[model samples]
Target: MKKILLLLTLAICSWSVLHAQDDTFKKYRENAAGKLKKAENDTTNRLWKKGATLSLTVNQGSLTNWAAGGDKFSLSIAGAFSGFANYRKDRHRWDNTMELAYGYVNTTSLGGRKSDDRIDLTSKYGYQIGKSLYASALMNLRTQMANGYLYTDTSDIFVSKFFAPAYLILSPGLDYIPNDEFSLFVSPITARWVFVLDDSLANVGSYGVDTGKHVNTEYGAYLTANWNKKVTENIVFKSRLDLFSNYKHNPKNIDVYWTNMLTMKVNKYLSANVSLDMIYDDDIRVFENKNTGVLGPRLQIKQVIGVGFTAVF
Candidate 1:
Protein backbone atom coordinates (compact mmCIF):
# COMPACT_ATOMS: atom_id res chain seq x y z
CA MET A 1 0.00 0.00 0.00
CA LYS A 2 2.88 2.50 0.72
CA LYS A 3 4.46 1.78 -2.70
CA ILE A 4 1.15 2.48 -4.47
CA LEU A 5 0.77 5.81 -2.54
CA LEU A 6 4.29 6.93 -3.55
CA LEU A 7 3.53 6.20 -7.22
CA LEU A 8 0.29 8.27 -7.05
CA THR A 9 2.15 11.25 -5.48
CA LEU A 10 4.76 11.29 -8.26
CA ALA A 11 2.07 11.32 -10.97
CA ILE A 12 0.26 14.30 -9.30
CA CYS A 13 3.48 16.29 -9.09
CA SER A 14 4.28 15.79 -12.77
CA TRP A 15 0.78 16.97 -13.83
CA SER A 16 0.97 20.09 -11.67
CA VAL A 17 4.36 21.14 -13.14
CA LEU A 18 3.06 20.73 -16.70
CA HIS A 19 0.00 22.90 -15.93
CA ALA A 20 2.17 25.70 -14.46
CA GLN A 21 4.44 25.81 -17.53
CA ASP A 22 1.43 26.11 -19.87
CA ASP A 23 0.01 29.04 -17.87
CA THR A 24 3.33 30.91 -18.00
CA PHE A 25 3.56 30.46 -21.76
CA LYS A 26 0.03 31.80 -22.21
CA LYS A 27 0.86 35.03 -20.32
CA TYR A 28 4.06 35.56 -22.33
CA ARG A 29 2.20 35.16 -25.63
CA GLU A 30 -0.39 37.74 -24.59
CA ASN A 31 2.28 40.29 -23.70
CA ALA A 32 4.05 39.83 -27.03
CA ALA A 33 0.79 40.27 -28.96
CA GLY A 34 -0.02 43.50 -27.13
CA LYS A 35 3.39 45.00 -27.99
CA LEU A 36 3.07 44.05 -31.64
CA LYS A 37 -0.34 45.77 -31.90
CA LYS A 38 1.02 49.01 -30.42
CA ALA A 39 3.89 49.01 -32.86
CA GLU A 40 1.56 48.57 -35.82
CA ASN A 41 -0.60 51.47 -34.69
CA ASP A 42 2.42 53.74 -34.49
CA THR A 43 3.49 52.79 -38.01
CA THR A 44 0.06 53.60 -39.43
CA ASN A 45 0.15 57.12 -38.00
CA ARG A 46 3.61 57.69 -39.42
CA LEU A 47 2.49 56.67 -42.91
CA TRP A 48 -0.27 59.32 -43.04
CA LYS A 49 0.77 62.93 -42.55
CA LYS A 50 -0.43 66.47 -43.17
CA GLY A 51 1.52 69.72 -43.22
CA ALA A 52 1.19 73.42 -44.07
CA THR A 53 3.40 76.48 -44.28
CA LEU A 54 2.78 80.18 -44.69
CA SER A 55 5.32 82.84 -45.58
CA LEU A 56 5.01 86.58 -45.83
CA THR A 57 7.72 88.84 -47.27
CA VAL A 58 7.81 92.59 -47.21
CA ASN A 59 10.07 95.27 -48.66
CA GLN A 60 10.00 99.00 -48.06
CA GLY A 61 12.15 101.97 -48.99
CA SER A 62 12.05 105.63 -47.92
CA LEU A 63 14.05 108.41 -49.54
CA THR A 64 14.10 111.94 -48.12
CA ASN A 65 16.87 113.21 -50.38
CA TRP A 66 18.73 110.10 -51.42
CA ALA A 67 21.40 110.47 -54.09
CA ALA A 68 21.66 106.99 -55.62
CA GLY A 69 18.31 107.52 -57.39
CA GLY A 70 16.03 104.55 -56.78
CA ASP A 71 12.27 104.11 -56.69
CA LYS A 72 11.39 106.58 -53.94
CA PHE A 73 8.91 105.55 -51.23
CA SER A 74 8.52 101.99 -52.47
CA LEU A 75 6.65 99.23 -50.80
CA SER A 76 6.17 95.59 -51.68
CA ILE A 77 4.41 92.68 -50.01
CA ALA A 78 4.45 89.00 -50.99
CA GLY A 79 2.73 86.03 -49.42
CA ALA A 80 2.84 82.29 -50.07
CA PHE A 81 0.69 79.44 -48.75
CA SER A 82 1.52 75.77 -49.14
CA GLY A 83 -0.20 72.69 -47.80
CA PHE A 84 0.26 68.99 -48.30
CA ALA A 85 -1.38 65.67 -47.43
CA ASN A 86 0.51 62.43 -48.01
CA TYR A 87 -0.19 58.77 -47.29
CA ARG A 88 1.64 55.56 -47.99
CA LYS A 89 0.73 52.10 -46.69
CA ASP A 90 1.26 48.66 -48.06
CA ARG A 91 1.51 49.39 -51.82
CA HIS A 92 -0.97 52.30 -51.82
CA ARG A 93 -0.28 56.02 -51.77
CA TRP A 94 -2.17 59.27 -52.07
CA ASP A 95 -0.44 62.62 -52.34
CA ASN A 96 -2.10 66.01 -52.50
CA THR A 97 -0.79 69.56 -52.44
CA MET A 98 -2.10 73.09 -52.76
CA GLU A 99 -0.14 76.30 -53.30
CA LEU A 100 -1.32 79.88 -53.49
CA ALA A 101 0.74 83.06 -53.81
CA TYR A 102 0.22 86.75 -54.50
CA GLY A 103 2.46 89.80 -54.42
CA TYR A 104 2.12 93.53 -55.06
CA VAL A 105 4.56 96.36 -55.40
CA ASN A 106 4.12 100.15 -55.42
CA THR A 107 6.90 102.52 -56.43
CA THR A 108 7.39 106.08 -57.62
CA SER A 109 8.02 105.07 -61.24
CA LEU A 110 6.00 101.87 -61.50
CA GLY A 111 3.01 103.08 -59.45
CA GLY A 112 1.11 100.00 -58.27
CA ARG A 113 1.56 96.60 -59.99
CA LYS A 114 1.24 92.92 -59.31
CA SER A 115 4.56 91.19 -58.95
CA ASP A 116 3.26 87.63 -58.63
CA ASP A 117 0.03 85.63 -58.73
CA ARG A 118 -0.54 81.89 -58.80
CA ILE A 119 -2.87 79.11 -57.67
CA ASP A 120 -1.94 75.49 -58.08
CA LEU A 121 -3.44 72.21 -56.83
CA THR A 122 -2.42 68.63 -57.49
CA SER A 123 -3.52 65.15 -56.40
CA LYS A 124 -1.90 61.86 -57.25
CA TYR A 125 -2.95 58.31 -56.38
CA GLY A 126 -0.85 55.23 -56.93
CA TYR A 127 -1.05 51.46 -56.59
CA GLN A 128 2.18 49.56 -56.64
CA ILE A 129 2.62 47.20 -59.56
CA GLY A 130 6.21 46.25 -58.90
CA LYS A 131 8.94 47.06 -56.43
CA SER A 132 9.50 50.54 -57.88
CA LEU A 133 6.73 50.92 -60.46
CA TYR A 134 3.17 52.00 -59.82
CA ALA A 135 -0.03 52.48 -61.75
CA SER A 136 -1.04 56.02 -61.06
CA ALA A 137 -3.49 58.78 -61.81
CA LEU A 138 -2.81 62.47 -61.33
CA MET A 139 -4.94 65.58 -61.59
CA ASN A 140 -3.54 69.08 -61.63
CA LEU A 141 -4.84 72.62 -62.03
CA ARG A 142 -2.93 75.85 -62.61
CA THR A 143 -4.41 79.32 -62.59
CA GLN A 144 -4.20 82.86 -61.22
CA MET A 145 -6.14 84.34 -58.35
CA ALA A 146 -6.23 87.93 -59.55
CA ASN A 147 -5.62 90.18 -62.50
CA GLY A 148 -2.11 90.46 -63.93
CA TYR A 149 -0.73 93.25 -66.09
CA LEU A 150 2.47 94.27 -67.82
CA TYR A 151 3.66 97.74 -66.90
CA THR A 152 4.98 100.12 -69.52
CA ASP A 153 5.49 103.86 -69.91
CA THR A 154 2.50 104.11 -72.23
CA SER A 155 -0.09 101.92 -70.52
CA ASP A 156 -0.58 98.84 -68.37
CA ILE A 157 -1.37 96.02 -70.78
CA PHE A 158 -3.74 93.48 -69.29
CA VAL A 159 -1.92 90.16 -69.52
CA SER A 160 -3.81 87.66 -67.32
CA LYS A 161 -6.79 87.55 -65.03
CA PHE A 162 -8.47 85.00 -62.78
CA PHE A 163 -9.18 81.83 -64.77
CA ALA A 164 -8.35 83.67 -67.95
CA PRO A 165 -5.72 81.14 -68.97
CA ALA A 166 -6.28 78.33 -66.51
CA TYR A 167 -4.96 74.87 -67.29
CA LEU A 168 -6.39 71.55 -66.09
CA ILE A 169 -4.74 68.21 -66.67
CA LEU A 170 -5.76 64.62 -65.94
CA SER A 171 -3.29 61.85 -66.57
CA PRO A 172 -3.24 58.10 -65.99
CA GLY A 173 0.35 57.00 -66.00
CA LEU A 174 3.05 54.70 -64.74
CA ASP A 175 4.99 56.18 -61.87
CA TYR A 176 8.53 55.38 -60.85
CA ILE A 177 9.10 56.28 -57.23
CA PRO A 178 12.39 54.92 -55.99
CA ASN A 179 12.26 56.94 -52.81
CA ASP A 180 10.52 59.81 -51.08
CA GLU A 181 12.64 62.55 -52.63
CA PHE A 182 12.21 61.86 -56.34
CA SER A 183 9.37 60.83 -58.67
CA LEU A 184 8.84 60.36 -62.38
CA PHE A 185 5.58 59.69 -64.25
CA VAL A 186 4.84 59.03 -67.90
CA SER A 187 1.42 58.78 -69.51
CA PRO A 188 0.73 57.75 -73.06
CA ILE A 189 -2.73 59.28 -72.82
CA THR A 190 -3.64 62.52 -71.13
CA ALA A 191 -6.47 65.00 -71.19
CA ARG A 192 -5.77 68.72 -70.99
CA TRP A 193 -8.11 71.66 -71.13
CA VAL A 194 -7.48 75.39 -71.32
CA PHE A 195 -10.22 77.60 -69.96
CA VAL A 196 -10.59 81.32 -70.52
CA LEU A 197 -13.42 82.39 -68.28
CA ASP A 198 -12.82 86.10 -68.68
CA ASP A 199 -14.70 87.36 -71.72
CA SER A 200 -12.17 90.04 -72.60
CA LEU A 201 -9.24 87.64 -72.55
CA ALA A 202 -11.21 85.08 -74.57
CA ASN A 203 -12.01 87.64 -77.27
CA VAL A 204 -8.37 88.37 -77.81
CA GLY A 205 -7.32 84.71 -77.44
CA SER A 206 -4.47 85.48 -75.01
CA TYR A 207 -3.19 82.00 -74.26
CA GLY A 208 -3.53 79.28 -76.93
CA VAL A 209 -7.36 79.26 -77.10
CA ASP A 210 -9.28 80.15 -80.23
CA THR A 211 -10.55 83.69 -80.57
CA GLY A 212 -13.93 84.11 -78.83
CA LYS A 213 -13.80 80.51 -77.64
CA HIS A 214 -14.15 79.70 -73.96
CA VAL A 215 -12.44 76.32 -73.81
CA ASN A 216 -9.83 74.36 -75.70
CA THR A 217 -9.36 70.62 -75.26
CA GLU A 218 -6.45 68.43 -76.24
CA TYR A 219 -5.35 64.82 -75.87
CA GLY A 220 -1.67 64.30 -75.35
CA ALA A 221 1.17 62.28 -73.94
CA TYR A 222 2.47 63.66 -70.67
CA LEU A 223 5.60 63.28 -68.59
CA THR A 224 6.53 64.83 -65.29
CA ALA A 225 9.55 64.66 -62.99
CA ASN A 226 9.85 65.91 -59.45
CA TRP A 227 12.77 66.08 -57.06
CA ASN A 228 13.29 67.55 -53.63
CA LYS A 229 16.26 67.31 -51.29
CA LYS A 230 18.02 69.08 -48.49
CA VAL A 231 21.16 70.28 -50.20
CA THR A 232 22.88 71.42 -46.99
CA GLU A 233 22.18 71.77 -43.33
CA ASN A 234 20.09 74.92 -43.85
CA ILE A 235 19.32 74.82 -47.55
CA VAL A 236 16.53 72.95 -49.39
CA PHE A 237 16.06 72.60 -53.12
CA LYS A 238 13.02 71.44 -55.14
CA SER A 239 12.36 71.17 -58.85
CA ARG A 240 9.63 69.97 -61.19
CA LEU A 241 9.60 69.50 -64.93
CA ASP A 242 6.57 68.78 -67.13
CA LEU A 243 6.34 67.90 -70.80
CA PHE A 244 3.32 67.27 -73.05
CA SER A 245 2.89 66.38 -76.69
CA ASN A 246 -0.51 66.75 -78.35
CA TYR A 247 -1.54 63.78 -80.48
CA LYS A 248 -3.76 65.61 -82.97
CA HIS A 249 -1.42 68.52 -83.62
CA ASN A 250 2.33 68.70 -84.20
CA PRO A 251 3.43 65.92 -81.88
CA LYS A 252 7.09 66.81 -82.18
CA ASN A 253 6.45 70.27 -80.72
CA ILE A 254 6.07 69.66 -77.03
CA ASP A 255 5.01 72.04 -74.29
CA VAL A 256 7.32 72.43 -71.34
CA TYR A 257 6.87 73.82 -67.84
CA TRP A 258 9.74 73.83 -65.38
CA THR A 259 10.11 75.36 -61.93
CA ASN A 260 12.78 75.41 -59.27
CA MET A 261 12.71 76.75 -55.70
CA LEU A 262 15.58 77.13 -53.27
CA THR A 263 15.18 78.00 -49.61
CA MET A 264 17.75 78.95 -47.00
CA LYS A 265 16.59 78.80 -43.45
CA VAL A 266 18.02 81.41 -41.11
CA ASN A 267 16.00 80.34 -38.12
CA LYS A 268 12.75 78.69 -37.17
CA TYR A 269 10.73 81.65 -38.43
CA LEU A 270 13.01 83.48 -40.87
CA SER A 271 14.03 82.29 -44.35
CA ALA A 272 15.28 83.45 -47.74
CA ASN A 273 13.98 82.00 -50.97
CA VAL A 274 14.62 82.06 -54.71
CA SER A 275 12.27 80.76 -57.40
CA LEU A 276 12.51 80.33 -61.16
CA ASP A 277 9.71 79.45 -63.60
CA MET A 278 9.99 78.71 -67.29
CA ILE A 279 7.34 77.84 -69.89
CA TYR A 280 7.26 77.00 -73.56
CA ASP A 281 3.95 76.47 -75.42
CA ASP A 282 3.82 76.09 -79.17
CA ASP A 283 0.24 77.36 -79.48
CA ILE A 284 0.82 80.58 -77.57
CA ARG A 285 2.17 83.37 -79.76
CA VAL A 286 4.46 85.92 -78.15
CA PHE A 287 6.37 88.75 -79.79
CA GLU A 288 9.18 90.67 -78.13
CA ASN A 289 8.79 93.65 -80.44
CA LYS A 290 6.03 93.64 -83.03
CA ASN A 291 7.73 96.27 -85.17
CA THR A 292 11.01 94.39 -85.59
CA GLY A 293 10.34 90.89 -84.19
CA VAL A 294 8.49 87.96 -85.73
CA LEU A 295 5.36 86.52 -84.19
CA GLY A 296 6.09 83.01 -82.93
CA PRO A 297 6.55 80.96 -79.82
CA ARG A 298 8.92 82.47 -77.27
CA LEU A 299 10.31 81.04 -74.10
CA GLN A 300 8.80 82.75 -71.03
CA ILE A 301 10.71 83.03 -67.80
CA LYS A 302 10.13 84.57 -64.35
CA GLN A 303 12.32 84.89 -61.28
CA VAL A 304 11.77 85.96 -57.68
CA ILE A 305 13.91 86.40 -54.56
CA GLY A 306 12.81 87.36 -51.09
CA VAL A 307 13.39 87.12 -47.35
CA GLY A 308 10.39 86.45 -45.22
CA PHE A 309 8.73 85.11 -42.08
CA THR A 310 7.88 81.48 -42.63
CA ALA A 311 6.02 78.88 -40.61
CA VAL A 312 6.20 75.17 -41.40
CA PHE A 313 4.41 72.12 -40.07
Candidate 2:
Protein backbone atom coordinates (compact mmCIF):
# COMPACT_ATOMS: atom_id res chain seq x y z
CA MET A 1 0.00 0.00 0.00
CA LYS A 2 2.86 2.45 0.81
CA LYS A 3 4.55 1.67 -2.57
CA ILE A 4 1.28 2.33 -4.44
CA LEU A 5 0.89 5.79 -2.72
CA LEU A 6 4.44 6.84 -3.67
CA LEU A 7 3.83 5.94 -7.34
CA LEU A 8 0.60 8.00 -7.45
CA THR A 9 2.41 11.04 -5.94
CA LEU A 10 5.17 10.83 -8.63
CA ALA A 11 2.54 10.67 -11.41
CA ILE A 12 0.76 13.76 -10.05
CA CYS A 13 4.07 15.71 -9.97
CA SER A 14 4.80 14.86 -13.66
CA TRP A 15 1.34 15.98 -14.79
CA SER A 16 1.69 19.37 -13.02
CA VAL A 17 5.09 20.04 -14.68
CA LEU A 18 3.69 19.26 -18.15
CA HIS A 19 0.71 21.55 -17.64
CA ALA A 20 2.95 24.46 -16.59
CA GLN A 21 5.18 24.01 -19.63
CA ASP A 22 2.17 24.00 -21.95
CA ASP A 23 0.82 27.22 -20.46
CA THR A 24 4.21 28.93 -20.86
CA PHE A 25 4.39 27.93 -24.54
CA LYS A 26 0.87 29.21 -25.23
CA LYS A 27 1.74 32.65 -23.79
CA TYR A 28 4.91 32.86 -25.87
CA ARG A 29 2.99 32.10 -29.05
CA GLU A 30 0.38 34.77 -28.31
CA ASN A 31 3.08 37.46 -27.76
CA ALA A 32 4.87 36.53 -30.99
CA ALA A 33 1.62 36.77 -32.99
CA GLY A 34 0.89 40.23 -31.61
CA LYS A 35 4.34 41.50 -32.64
CA LEU A 36 3.96 40.13 -36.16
CA LYS A 37 0.57 41.82 -36.59
CA LYS A 38 2.00 45.14 -35.51
CA ALA A 39 4.86 44.83 -37.97
CA GLU A 40 2.44 44.15 -40.84
CA ASN A 41 0.37 47.23 -40.00
CA ASP A 42 3.46 49.41 -39.92
CA THR A 43 4.50 48.18 -43.35
CA THR A 44 1.04 48.89 -44.77
CA ASN A 45 0.91 52.52 -43.47
CA ARG A 46 3.53 54.82 -44.94
CA LEU A 47 3.87 57.76 -42.56
CA TRP A 48 6.85 59.43 -44.22
CA LYS A 49 5.85 61.17 -47.44
CA LYS A 50 5.88 64.52 -49.25
CA GLY A 51 3.12 67.11 -48.95
CA ALA A 52 1.85 70.14 -50.87
CA THR A 53 -0.50 73.05 -50.28
CA LEU A 54 -2.51 75.46 -52.43
CA SER A 55 -4.37 78.48 -51.13
CA LEU A 56 -6.35 81.54 -52.26
CA THR A 57 -7.50 84.72 -50.51
CA VAL A 58 -9.81 87.65 -51.25
CA ASN A 59 -10.09 90.86 -49.20
CA GLN A 60 -11.91 94.23 -49.26
CA GLY A 61 -11.86 97.28 -47.02
CA SER A 62 -12.09 101.11 -46.69
CA LEU A 63 -10.21 103.88 -44.88
CA THR A 64 -11.86 106.27 -42.47
CA ASN A 65 -11.25 110.03 -42.25
CA TRP A 66 -8.76 111.98 -40.14
CA ALA A 67 -6.63 113.98 -42.59
CA ALA A 68 -5.54 114.06 -46.30
CA GLY A 69 -8.43 114.51 -48.70
CA GLY A 70 -9.36 113.49 -52.27
CA ASP A 71 -12.18 111.04 -51.74
CA LYS A 72 -13.45 111.24 -48.16
CA PHE A 73 -13.21 107.44 -48.09
CA SER A 74 -11.69 104.74 -50.35
CA LEU A 75 -12.50 101.31 -51.64
CA SER A 76 -9.87 98.63 -52.18
CA ILE A 77 -9.97 94.97 -53.20
CA ALA A 78 -7.11 92.49 -53.16
CA GLY A 79 -6.52 88.80 -53.80
CA ALA A 80 -3.69 86.34 -53.53
CA PHE A 81 -3.01 82.80 -54.75
CA SER A 82 -0.17 80.73 -53.37
CA GLY A 83 1.12 77.17 -53.54
CA PHE A 84 3.92 75.17 -51.93
CA ALA A 85 5.43 71.71 -52.19
CA ASN A 86 7.80 70.28 -49.63
CA TYR A 87 9.49 67.01 -48.69
CA ARG A 88 9.75 66.36 -44.98
CA LYS A 89 12.26 63.93 -43.49
CA ASP A 90 12.30 62.95 -39.82
CA ARG A 91 10.33 65.27 -37.53
CA HIS A 92 12.06 68.65 -37.84
CA ARG A 93 13.94 68.68 -41.12
CA TRP A 94 13.02 69.33 -44.74
CA ASP A 95 15.26 69.37 -47.79
CA ASN A 96 13.54 72.05 -49.80
CA THR A 97 10.28 73.78 -50.64
CA MET A 98 9.09 75.43 -53.85
CA GLU A 99 6.79 78.33 -53.20
CA LEU A 100 4.93 80.59 -55.66
CA ALA A 101 2.54 83.45 -55.03
CA TYR A 102 0.67 86.04 -57.09
CA GLY A 103 -1.15 89.05 -55.69
CA TYR A 104 -3.24 91.90 -57.17
CA VAL A 105 -4.97 94.93 -55.72
CA ASN A 106 -7.12 97.86 -56.94
CA THR A 107 -7.91 100.97 -54.95
CA THR A 108 -10.10 104.07 -55.47
CA SER A 109 -9.06 106.72 -53.01
CA LEU A 110 -9.19 110.50 -52.54
CA GLY A 111 -5.68 110.51 -54.02
CA GLY A 112 -6.86 108.76 -57.27
CA ARG A 113 -7.31 105.37 -58.91
CA LYS A 114 -4.45 103.04 -57.92
CA SER A 115 -3.53 99.47 -58.77
CA ASP A 116 -0.71 97.09 -57.84
CA ASP A 117 0.29 93.56 -58.75
CA ARG A 118 3.11 91.33 -57.59
CA ILE A 119 4.59 87.93 -58.33
CA ASP A 120 6.79 86.24 -55.72
CA LEU A 121 8.99 83.18 -56.08
CA THR A 122 10.68 81.65 -53.10
CA SER A 123 12.78 78.58 -52.27
CA LYS A 124 13.63 77.47 -48.78
CA TYR A 125 16.03 74.99 -47.15
CA GLY A 126 15.53 73.91 -43.56
CA TYR A 127 17.66 72.10 -40.98
CA GLN A 128 17.10 71.01 -37.44
CA ILE A 129 19.45 72.70 -35.01
CA GLY A 130 18.36 70.67 -31.98
CA LYS A 131 15.34 68.92 -30.53
CA SER A 132 13.05 71.96 -30.58
CA LEU A 133 15.26 74.29 -32.59
CA TYR A 134 15.30 74.79 -36.38
CA ALA A 135 17.17 76.93 -38.84
CA SER A 136 16.09 77.94 -42.37
CA ALA A 137 17.14 80.21 -45.16
CA LEU A 138 15.02 81.48 -48.02
CA MET A 139 15.80 83.01 -51.38
CA ASN A 140 13.13 85.23 -52.89
CA LEU A 141 12.67 86.99 -56.24
CA ARG A 142 9.86 89.51 -56.48
CA THR A 143 8.47 91.58 -59.37
CA GLN A 144 5.94 94.35 -58.86
CA MET A 145 3.65 96.34 -61.17
CA ALA A 146 2.20 99.59 -59.84
CA ASN A 147 0.15 102.51 -61.21
CA GLY A 148 -1.11 105.34 -59.09
CA TYR A 149 -1.42 109.10 -58.51
CA LEU A 150 -0.76 111.22 -55.40
CA TYR A 151 -2.75 114.43 -54.88
CA THR A 152 -1.08 116.94 -52.55
CA ASP A 153 -3.77 119.57 -52.96
CA THR A 154 -6.59 120.50 -55.38
CA SER A 155 -3.94 122.19 -57.58
CA ASP A 156 -1.03 119.71 -57.36
CA ILE A 157 -1.46 116.51 -59.35
CA PHE A 158 1.06 113.66 -59.89
CA VAL A 159 0.60 111.47 -62.94
CA SER A 160 0.63 107.70 -62.84
CA LYS A 161 3.60 105.86 -64.37
CA PHE A 162 3.70 102.13 -65.02
CA PHE A 163 6.84 100.56 -63.62
CA ALA A 164 8.20 97.18 -62.53
CA PRO A 165 10.89 96.63 -59.87
CA ALA A 166 12.63 93.33 -59.28
CA TYR A 167 14.70 92.38 -56.27
CA LEU A 168 16.20 89.38 -54.49
CA ILE A 169 16.19 88.97 -50.70
CA LEU A 170 18.16 86.46 -48.64
CA SER A 171 16.76 85.66 -45.20
CA PRO A 172 18.17 83.25 -42.62
CA GLY A 173 16.58 82.72 -39.25
CA LEU A 174 16.38 80.39 -36.26
CA ASP A 175 13.30 79.15 -34.47
CA TYR A 176 12.87 78.12 -30.81
CA ILE A 177 9.90 75.91 -30.19
CA PRO A 178 9.13 75.09 -26.58
CA ASN A 179 6.36 72.76 -27.58
CA ASP A 180 5.04 71.07 -30.70
CA GLU A 181 3.03 74.07 -31.96
CA PHE A 182 4.48 77.24 -30.41
CA SER A 183 7.62 79.03 -31.58
CA LEU A 184 9.47 82.33 -31.37
CA PHE A 185 12.15 83.63 -33.71
CA VAL A 186 14.53 86.51 -33.33
CA SER A 187 16.76 87.39 -36.28
CA PRO A 188 19.12 90.22 -35.38
CA ILE A 189 20.18 90.80 -38.97
CA THR A 190 18.66 90.68 -42.47
CA ALA A 191 19.91 92.30 -45.68
CA ARG A 192 17.93 93.52 -48.70
CA TRP A 193 19.38 95.12 -51.82
CA VAL A 194 17.46 96.31 -54.87
CA PHE A 195 19.17 95.30 -58.13
CA VAL A 196 17.87 98.46 -59.80
CA LEU A 197 16.51 96.60 -62.80
CA ASP A 198 14.69 99.73 -64.01
CA ASP A 199 15.50 103.36 -63.22
CA SER A 200 12.23 104.85 -64.43
CA LEU A 201 10.86 105.52 -60.93
CA ALA A 202 14.21 106.34 -59.36
CA ASN A 203 14.51 109.83 -60.90
CA VAL A 204 10.84 110.70 -60.58
CA GLY A 205 9.45 111.70 -57.19
CA SER A 206 5.72 112.35 -57.13
CA TYR A 207 5.42 113.23 -53.44
CA GLY A 208 8.44 115.57 -53.60
CA VAL A 209 10.78 117.07 -56.18
CA ASP A 210 13.59 114.86 -57.54
CA THR A 211 16.65 115.48 -55.36
CA GLY A 212 19.18 113.44 -57.33
CA LYS A 213 19.57 109.67 -56.94
CA HIS A 214 18.31 108.41 -53.56
CA VAL A 215 19.95 105.35 -52.11
CA ASN A 216 17.76 102.26 -51.45
CA THR A 217 19.98 99.69 -49.73
CA GLU A 218 18.21 98.41 -46.64
CA TYR A 219 19.58 96.39 -43.69
CA GLY A 220 17.30 95.47 -40.83
CA ALA A 221 16.43 93.21 -37.91
CA TYR A 222 13.27 91.19 -37.55
CA LEU A 223 11.40 89.31 -34.83
CA THR A 224 8.50 86.90 -35.14
CA ALA A 225 6.31 84.88 -32.77
CA ASN A 226 3.82 82.22 -33.73
CA TRP A 227 1.24 80.26 -31.77
CA ASN A 228 -0.96 77.41 -32.92
CA LYS A 229 -3.54 75.74 -30.69
CA LYS A 230 -6.04 73.03 -31.50
CA VAL A 231 -9.56 74.18 -30.62
CA THR A 232 -11.24 71.05 -31.89
CA GLU A 233 -10.54 68.06 -34.09
CA ASN A 234 -11.19 70.17 -37.18
CA ILE A 235 -10.64 73.73 -35.96
CA VAL A 236 -7.50 75.56 -34.89
CA PHE A 237 -6.37 79.00 -33.72
CA LYS A 238 -3.29 80.55 -35.31
CA SER A 239 -1.67 83.87 -34.55
CA ARG A 240 1.54 85.55 -35.71
CA LEU A 241 3.31 88.84 -35.01
CA ASP A 242 6.12 90.22 -37.14
CA LEU A 243 8.15 93.30 -36.35
CA PHE A 244 11.01 94.80 -38.37
CA SER A 245 13.09 97.94 -38.71
CA ASN A 246 15.21 99.15 -41.62
CA TYR A 247 18.27 101.32 -41.07
CA LYS A 248 19.44 102.88 -44.29
CA HIS A 249 22.23 105.35 -45.09
CA ASN A 250 20.62 108.02 -42.92
CA PRO A 251 19.82 106.88 -39.41
CA LYS A 252 16.69 109.04 -39.23
CA ASN A 253 15.60 107.68 -42.59
CA ILE A 254 14.80 104.35 -40.98
CA ASP A 255 11.60 102.43 -41.61
CA VAL A 256 9.80 100.61 -38.80
CA TYR A 257 6.81 98.36 -39.28
CA TRP A 258 4.66 95.74 -37.65
CA THR A 259 2.10 93.22 -38.84
CA ASN A 260 -0.28 91.09 -36.78
CA MET A 261 -2.57 88.38 -38.08
CA LEU A 262 -5.08 86.02 -36.50
CA THR A 263 -6.55 83.13 -38.42
CA MET A 264 -9.39 80.77 -37.61
CA LYS A 265 -9.23 77.44 -39.36
CA VAL A 266 -12.68 76.24 -40.25
CA ASN A 267 -11.31 73.07 -41.79
CA LYS A 268 -8.38 71.77 -43.74
CA TYR A 269 -9.78 73.48 -46.82
CA LEU A 270 -10.97 76.87 -45.54
CA SER A 271 -9.97 79.62 -43.13
CA ALA A 272 -10.51 83.29 -42.31
CA ASN A 273 -8.03 85.94 -41.26
CA VAL A 274 -7.92 89.39 -39.69
CA SER A 275 -4.76 91.41 -40.14
CA LEU A 276 -3.41 94.79 -39.08
CA ASP A 277 -0.38 96.54 -40.52
CA MET A 278 1.39 99.78 -39.64
CA ILE A 279 4.32 101.51 -41.34
CA TYR A 280 6.34 104.53 -40.27
CA ASP A 281 8.90 106.22 -42.50
CA ASP A 282 11.06 109.20 -41.62
CA ASP A 283 12.40 109.90 -45.13
CA ILE A 284 9.03 109.91 -46.81
CA ARG A 285 7.73 112.43 -44.33
CA VAL A 286 10.84 114.61 -44.62
CA PHE A 287 10.41 114.92 -48.41
CA GLU A 288 6.66 115.44 -48.40
CA ASN A 289 6.89 118.90 -50.01
CA LYS A 290 9.49 119.81 -52.64
CA ASN A 291 10.14 123.30 -51.20
CA THR A 292 9.18 123.70 -47.52
CA GLY A 293 10.14 120.12 -46.47
CA VAL A 294 7.99 118.62 -43.70
CA LEU A 295 10.38 116.27 -41.89
CA GLY A 296 8.83 114.15 -39.15
CA PRO A 297 7.13 110.86 -38.51
CA ARG A 298 4.85 109.49 -41.22
CA LEU A 299 2.31 106.84 -40.33
CA GLN A 300 -0.02 104.62 -42.34
CA ILE A 301 -2.50 102.11 -41.02
CA LYS A 302 -4.29 99.25 -42.76
CA GLN A 303 -6.91 96.73 -41.66
CA VAL A 304 -8.30 93.82 -43.60
CA ILE A 305 -10.66 90.86 -43.25
CA GLY A 306 -10.42 87.92 -45.64
CA VAL A 307 -11.60 84.41 -46.39
CA GLY A 308 -9.47 81.76 -48.02
CA PHE A 309 -9.37 78.17 -49.19
CA THR A 310 -6.38 75.98 -48.36
CA ALA A 311 -5.54 72.51 -49.53
CA VAL A 312 -2.75 70.16 -48.55
CA PHE A 313 -1.53 67.20 -50.52
* Best prediction by lDDT: 1
Model 2 score (lDDT):
0.56
lDDT of each: 0.91, 0.56
Please give the lDDT score at residue 17 for candidate 2.
Answer: 96
Tens-place lDDT digits, model 1, residues 43-99: 988899999989999999888778877876899999999899999888899999998
Write candidate 2's Cα lDDT for 6-47 as tens digits: 999999999999999999999999999999999886754543
How many clashing residue pairs are found in candidate 2?
2
**Model 2: which residue pairs collide?**
70-110, 71-110
Off by over 4 Å in 2: 1-77, 95-122, 140-143, 151-167, 195-198, 204-215, 218-220, 226-254, 263-273, 281-297, 306-313
Tell how far residue 82 is off in model 1, in angstroms. Answer: 1.7
